[model samples]
Target: MSFKNLLLLCSIIWLGVSCKSEKEDPGPSGPGVPASFGFNSLKVNGAYSGFKYNDVNLKPKVRFTFSAPINNATVANGVTFQSASGEKIAFTSVQEGGDSSVVITPSADLKYLTSYSVTATKALKSKAGGMLLNEVKVELITALDATDKFPVISDEALLTLVQRQTFKYFWDFAHPVSGLARERDSSGDVVTSGGSGFGIMTIPIAIERKFITRAQGLERMQKIVSFLKKAQTFHGAFPHWLNGATGVVVPFSDKDNGADLVETSFLVQGLLTVRQYFNEGNAAETALRADINAIWEAVEWDWFRKNNENVLYWHWSPNFGWDMNHQIRGWNECLVTYALAASSPTHSIDKTVYDNGWAGNSTFRNGNEYYGTTLPLGEPLGGPLFFSHYSFLGLNPTGLTDRFANYFTQNKAHTLINYNYCKANPQQYYGYSDQCWGLTASDIPNGYNANSPSNDKGVITPTAALSAFPYTPTESMKALKFFYYKLGDKLWGEYGFRDAFSLDQLWFADTYLAIDQGPIVVMIENYRSGLPWKLCMSSPEVKTGLKKLGFTSPAL
Candidate 1:
């Protein structure tokens, strides 16, 4: 069927048919060691497919012992338990089991009743040689309870809701994933065809693990699987906006005449995000993966592959439209990020994608060229230039990590501190004009600055740009906390999160679309938590790509 499904089958085959046994001496402990008489198991008894069942439940316990003497020669110092996902599980009780064993219960409820594969270990230091340790694993199946209620929305549910919205906003045929209602102008037209209202699919999957349970997040992912199988293009590049009514590629010329690599990168991130859940024979994750693989195979990097002099060109309008074949920093940023993320060191992509025509000095400008570039006074780069923001600091998948990290970290911290301070003295900052205030921040106080367009002094949001912070978490978290918690009133909105920081300017559109929030939610989640990237690394396509890149570790 789908490549993702095929990969899932392969993973199952790999796990079931083969047993990989390492030869290194087992230390003080290893795999399985329950705290109680018998080990515990956690599995979804009735879950046959992705989000197929209503709910699941299970009981878990640990097995251990404590009868030995005070002589430090024999028994293990203590026992420790951990879940497969790396979270610690506390043992409930340590009572005597019959004559030789002991029983132990868990301190908290198991994360979710789906299927928890656990490992317990016992440690003992030895004076004679190396320390001694023992461990064991347990898999238990939990039954589905039709009467069990679904969870209510809470602050903790924000991540999960964003994820579901990511899938729902894009794939309308399945369960209704939630998100900000699509934004609209007074005339009722969507702001930018591909800008504010476009639904950003697959993004939530990339980052939902930061705040929600895996089962809760993926329950919404199945719709994305079904949606992507149906969305395709002949040349391979996914479009900037899928038609709101029919699910086909919506015709839009302002951006790449419809096929934009920047948008495609966001889609690619989403596809990779859901990949991890396909294991255990889940159909949806696998199906979606195959479509994504095909899409990746069909992408034409040739459009951006130019080198008129030595400088690289970014966006390409198939019809020679605006910014056609022009070199722009904004485009380069996302392009490099995607290429590096998808590249294999050994199987390097054809050099053509990086050799396209370069733009004139006037056309190809950056912050350095701001003084000469034709634009509003002190309004360098004008509107929300997606490419420049991600590229300038080297934050993309393939750019200079050190430089990008510095740029993002500094900017993010500055934004947080600004908002933190702004909260106290809103009157001083709020009244100033965007450009005046924006310029003042850089010219006078100098530290944190505002996003462009002057309208968003710091308040009006940049849906796409702000979301890129996931690539740099330490910085992203600072911005998010400031916007949501510190600058609470203006920033956070109802349908989904707003476009940018409120102090700059804030607007909440009625309908939620994929393009704006999808990448933001997914990437931010990944930054706060690494689940999405982890899942992508688990895929065969990524695994093969990494191996080709000369990596010894298994794919992500």
Candidate 2:
């Protein structure tokens, strides 16, 4: 008690003295005073770090700067710098100083007129190896402003459209087929030769690429080249589909039993014609031309001559009898169109035969009498039949500007008038037609009723025959501004475009794809640039087919 009381009184007196005095009162000396270890200083770098645009192109760079250098301490290993949005905007080059700094190179294109922040951190280690530090933040902006008149369909969007369609759906991280595999009816799912329909969806994407969004109309010329280079194939053909479980071609179409050069030819035509948009005599153009030529050569067109039909057969179904006489107009048009479009002064002689002879037969105008056999006994596949599948007519008479324009306008008007029946109401069919210029119609027949054949029911895909054709800018633009823009996310999907739009039904409830979009793209560019006309002039098939169909240069 006596010692404790004395010690307590001394402590109290020492505390009072220490508090009042300026000089330190060192209680008991410690060996080499331990350094103060705690979150004493907070530091950060204020710099905007993100991708910048040179005009519309991405300008890659790492941008970072520090507010002040760190002193008397080292940073922790796992400490990270991030943006306000919690994104890791780290610097590849980090240096500690009274002014600590880091530099980070962005992998993506930056938005114009935008700023970003950089952040840093410092950690003080205790003798126990535990850590203590405060996080820091900083920021800076790019120098370039967001005012560049770039192409409406920029590279970024193009890459995005292609990649998403191919990767997310077509190949499904597997491989794309090269040759023909399956035969698709107008309304069925476009499956592969092996009957494997589980692959990432390919039909809608193909349609949209060719038809709805023809903005980069000719840029797609390189797509086939890229596709061929990337496609995994057997015997010059592609698997019609990827098996969901096996990731291989499942053989879903009539052509699935064997290589289908006919479909390949159609695709090749699109690629070749579109290539003309690029500066001529360039490596890309030359390479594309060469690849397409090789592909055409590899195809055994003789394989198509079935049972001495003289015309190409639809497909070689392993299970069913080959799809013989059901010759689809759209497919036939592509084969002839692309072949003719690729004709050149150097190769015109061989290709021109298609233009001047049987292909030019006038019976085709009647839409009957192919190979001395009548078409499937149906009401002449009406207004929206062939036109709904491919915009071939749009690309056909491109050589004659006035005639082509007239045809295009008529075709577009017909599509507008037929699909969207509001323009032709009972009370206002004629006088009110002008009011519904941009509205597309439901696929329902003219006098559609619930009890009609299943195929007669109405269904409009957002990315249907209409949306993907970006060739007629004035018309497409008017339609886009009026229809697409107005529809917004309702009809438009996250992908580049959808299949069709439903005016009477739920917006995008049910949709299927056909080979619609691709031609739209080629046709738009062909008309806009007048390249298809030149190419057709170079081809015998086109001349022959045009003549056989009674189509003239002026195409009345």
TM-score, each model? 0.45, 0.43
Per-residue lDDT over 326-352 for candidate 1, one digit per residue giving the tens place of the 0 to 100 score: 443322234333343335232234423
User: How many pairs of residues collide in model 2?
Assistant: 79
Tell how far residue 80 is off in model 1, in angstroms: 74
| Per-residue accuracy of model 2 over 251-343 as CA lDDT, tens digit each | 544446544434444444444333332335767656766675565444444444445343444455544556434442331233343233233
Lowest-scoring 10 consecutive residues by lDDT in candidate 2? 194-203
Segments of candidate 1 deviating more than 4 angstroms: 1-234, 245-247, 254-256, 282-285, 303-323, 328-333, 336-428, 431-450, 453-458, 462-493, 500-513, 536-556
Off by over 4 Å in 2: 1-249, 254-256, 259-262, 274-288, 318-325, 328-381, 385-394, 399-422, 425-456, 462-478, 509-556
10 residues in a row with least lDDT, candidate 1: 435-444
Clashes of each: 72, 79
Model 1: per-residue Cα lDDT at residue 493: 47
